[model samples]
Target: MKVVVQVKLTPSPEVATALEATLRSCNDAANWLSLRAQDREEDRDRTRKALQSFAYAELKARGLSAQPALHVIRKVADAYSTRKANLKAGNYGRKDSKRYQRIADNPVRFRADAAQSYDDRCLSWQYDAGTVSIWTTAGRIRGVPFVGLPGAVKTLAEYRRGETDLVHRDGIWCLIATCEVPAADLNTEPDGFLGVDLGIANIATTSDEGEPFAGEKLNKYRRRQIRIRAELQARGTRSAKRKLKKRACREARHATHINHVISKRIVAAAERTGRGIGLEDLTGIRERVRFAKPQRVALHSWAFAQLAAFVKYKAARAGVPFVQVDPAYTSQMCSWCGHTEKANRPTQELFACRSCGVVAHADHNAARNIAVRAEHVWAAVNQPHAADTSGAPAASAAPQGSRS
Candidate 1:
């Protein structure tokens, strides 16, 4: 598995200036290349090498060396690849829609100080000395100190692999290094599956009747951020825009930290009890769920996919089996009984089954249902093709209730 570790770089004024110039040059060149490639970007395999051949000479003349110039070309190529993928995925709306046309026609643009990738040739890390020797527009800068926790620094020294990105965000410079770590063996015969239902209010609730990982504090923080962002956007001033960027970055960092914490705890719990981690297959949930204007911001503010990613990776590292089960009717289905009726969930928080007369927290009940489904799905997928799964855990989602 691959993970990224970011360390803050404390560079001298001269080195910082050179680093800034390098990024600007790299991104500026990228924009120039993007305009040329957007037309032929659909044929990535054909265009990537062609772009490198044509753009490299011009980039060298524009103050970049051989390696940085090539990196710039690849970066622009990757950007358009991403753009095409997003369009194909209908992220910007239908092909006939104005939003789709606008994004499709326009060339990908990058900010002046956008992060730039550096390979081993351009960057070298010295964890013992907490310093790096990095190539810059003003030539090579050596002994640039990086700040990070002792344990994290140790991990980086041991497992750091591939390229590092030089990012300049809100007056701070950092190197984000990718680390290749080994994943633990999959726990095939897990005791059982621990179902986790993810939501906005109660970030995650487990099937084992554990306390929900509530995001009360984060919700409050996000609310304040939203209000502040609105006020800043209304100001329409340069300083407000700068502050807006800073606030957004701050909120993202906090959210990422929270996701890491929640994923670590959940993975640890599942591993300790020799249980697999089961999650709802919430792919495309944002596009599926409808919400009022007042709730849209709150509902969409949280990153469900990011949280799921954290859990999956952490679980993999801990030798815990992680799988996503179908999420249809989980909310309205009863765990005690297979009764599936809309009335089973009268409110968002409470679930009272009319058939079994069982009352429980809505998310907790849904999590339990997910656990049952996960067991069946895991068995069906893991066993041999001809193996019979007739005895696997199963439930009928048909809306059968006492009222019928």
Candidate 2:
């Protein structure tokens, strides 16, 4: 239930310069590390360590406490190791994605440290405004110029009782907040399980019920992305390189904003129904979908992992149940008669359940089936315990455990 509230920082000119200098120092360390590694003039590990030490000194000089250089060095080394493995696997191209290649070549960059200003938590900042300063911590960061906080800051109680995270992108920061106010009691109890099918085409679908949500707006945003990609690809010049970076930032902002909205709606609907949430056990979905490049890209872009994460945390806050069932037959099985076969879904949209002759939207039927399955799981797991009149776990509900 822990949540983080990312408040925007409005630093003075001096603070802005200091912050930029710190970031550049780390970036330079990365550059120098790469050069040293390529030249083979110094031990790659030793050179990286030296660069990290310098970055740490820079932070100390700025009066902003940061983690020891070794801490950052380890992180960078890990990233480099992982990326190098990816490169060797041939999943990534060199010239086509120079940025990634560079990152793979040199991974370590910066580190964080506990500071009193941010409640003794690691402080990090980018794109600092001379007049405004924003930072994050377990609690609020005070003493900053602003038109008040950009968004509402949650109290400690609220933070500890809900799901939240602080993610940064494009130099502009955000506090991805989730507040779960109690909803009116559901009128009709969920009769059975509801199967959820997640994919690129419709985003999410429930069995029996229609698609609770479709990312049509997001599709429009993707169109803009295509145009931006086309324009960037067409130029292939220095200016285009700069524009490409900006385009990446713009795309990230749009996607985050849209995702926040979509996650909230989807989770809220499940809570309102007072039913368990079901999701496909998308373990290794990427590998399974790799045959179709465009499909892989779309599925990856949708980031169903993030969505499922949101659903999980929100469900816990609402005292609802969630389950990850086998995705193998969830889609292929006919929701009406339990006829589990691929032929049941002959077309993408049409689902004429041959055994029961139930014709419906393919995805919707899948979702309904998922939900129904989840309910059975809930009953099985909690049947031994007495159900409270409120239909929620008792007052001594255990802490919501994470999925790995």
**Which candidate gets the maximum TM-score versus the true structure?**
1
Q: How well does candidate 1 score on lDDT at residue 145?
A: 92
| Whole-model Cα lDDT of every candidate shown, in order | 0.85, 0.53
lDDT of 1 at 394: 42
lDDT for predicted candidate 1 compared with the true structure: 0.85
Question: For model 1, how does the per-residue alpha-carbon lDDT over 54-100 read when each residue is reduced to its tens digit?
Answer: 78899999989899998998888788778788999998999999999
The residue ranges of model 2 lying beyond 4 angstroms of the native Cα positions read: 26-142, 146-152, 155-194, 215-217, 290-294, 379-404
List model 2 lDDT by residue over 1-404, tens digit each. 54344544444565444444544454444444444444443435544565565455654453333542333344345555565577777667764598666755553443321111221133322213312223321122334343224333433223323322333344533334343445333323453444567877777776534444565666666767877777888989999988888987777766666656665666566666655567777777887755476666667666677767776665666655667865656667665556667787888777776555567677776765566556555565666363322222122322121211
lDDT of model 2 at position 300: 64
lDDT for 179 (candidate 1): 92
Name the lDDT value of residue 274 in candidate 1: 96
For every candidate structure, what is the RMSD over all alpha carbons to the true structure, in angstroms?
Answer: 3.9, 10.1
